[model samples]
Target: MIALTSPLLWYTARASGIVSLLLLTAVMALGVMTATRVGGRPMPRFAVAEVHRRIALMTMIFLVLHILTTVLDTYVHIGLLAALIPFTSAYKTVWVAFGSVAFDLLLAVTIASLLKQRISHAAWRAIHWLSYVSFPIAIIHVLMIGTDTRFPWMLLLVAGCVGTLFLAIAWRLWAHPRPDGALTAVPRRKGRPGTTATASTQHAPRGRKIASSGQTRKPR
Candidate 1:
């Protein structure tokens, strides 16, 4: 148990936590891109959305573990209450609070999602929209509170978020092409065999043919 409290262990836990958070953010972004419908064309694969959701859930799990381990470490003086409350940490109050706020939003979204079947569809949808809110909050939290924010790896993480969102928007526009009502009805050509009013009479059965005088003709 002492090993878990060591500085080395603490660093490892924080690293894992950051990576998990990044993964979750990417997954959630993918979900948003997939769910959007522009002009009636949807993203190609349902599996992509499912994978995103599942990976996010897993990320949350790892995050909880990361928090627990970090708080338990004797080297770091984070209190349990501080973990839940915003701007209450003895160390880095302002930046740490960002993480607290993000954590709360994430918890709310995860719980609501798990209970979706029990909740009304409208209510669930409204809460689900909060996932977008959580994503940016999480990003801000990492940017502000993360110990290695200045590192090259951290820069890559931020870039990944921007790149993925850009690609998603571009792909969405390309896939859904809308027509301008130009070809609603095809025009009929003149002098065609079946085009004129007389064509109906010409195609009538022999027994039911009408005479030129408008009387029905008897079968021969």
Candidate 2:
């Protein structure tokens, strides 16, 4: 009974870690979807953007907790520094680096956004675009680091992320469809000769008016 319970607990922890990662990836994707203008449509509502931002921050918080718990459980030998740095992990250096890269990208984007007012809008906007890169890196990181990657449920999670992102891209492309109305020369109206005739000549008086005084009034 003790042996069985120990394995079950370990499995639960492993499952929780993957779940946390998946949620974080989803939060990142939501942020991207909200930031980008879809199909020539205006930006998402301020409320929507704010909600996404808050959710993303929460996701990050949960991710940190997840990492901490996983490390504490002792099932894996991941160190504190290893969690922050890429390619230093004992598990899989290259695949693990993907998570680190994603973390750096996410950090850049979050910092720039938080200091948007301090930085030039153009520069901030440029940095914010890194969110796109962050999202994909996050997905890759989860797929590689997750212990339950082979499970049917894990496969579904991966599919959902990829599918949603692809759909977003497709929608953006199809909705904005190239500017067909642009670059076409407008047809000029043809002008007729003598088109600017004088208005006074066109409205010439037919006859002159004359006034007559029928009687003279005495002055008071």
Considering every candidate listed, which one attains the maximal lDDT?
Answer: 1
Assess candidate 2 and give its lDDT.
0.61
Q: Residue 39 of model 2: what lDDT?
A: 19
How many residue pairs in model 1 have overlapping backbones?
0
Clash count list over all predictions: 0, 0
TM-score of each: 0.68, 0.65
Tell me the lDDT of model 1 at 121.
84
Candidate 2 minimal-lDDT segment of 10 residues: 195-204
For model 1, how does the per-residue alpha-carbon lDDT over 27-113 read when each residue is reduced to its tens digit?
666665555522222333455556777887887887777677767876767777887799888877876677777777778878888
Which prediction has the highest TM-score against the true structure? 1
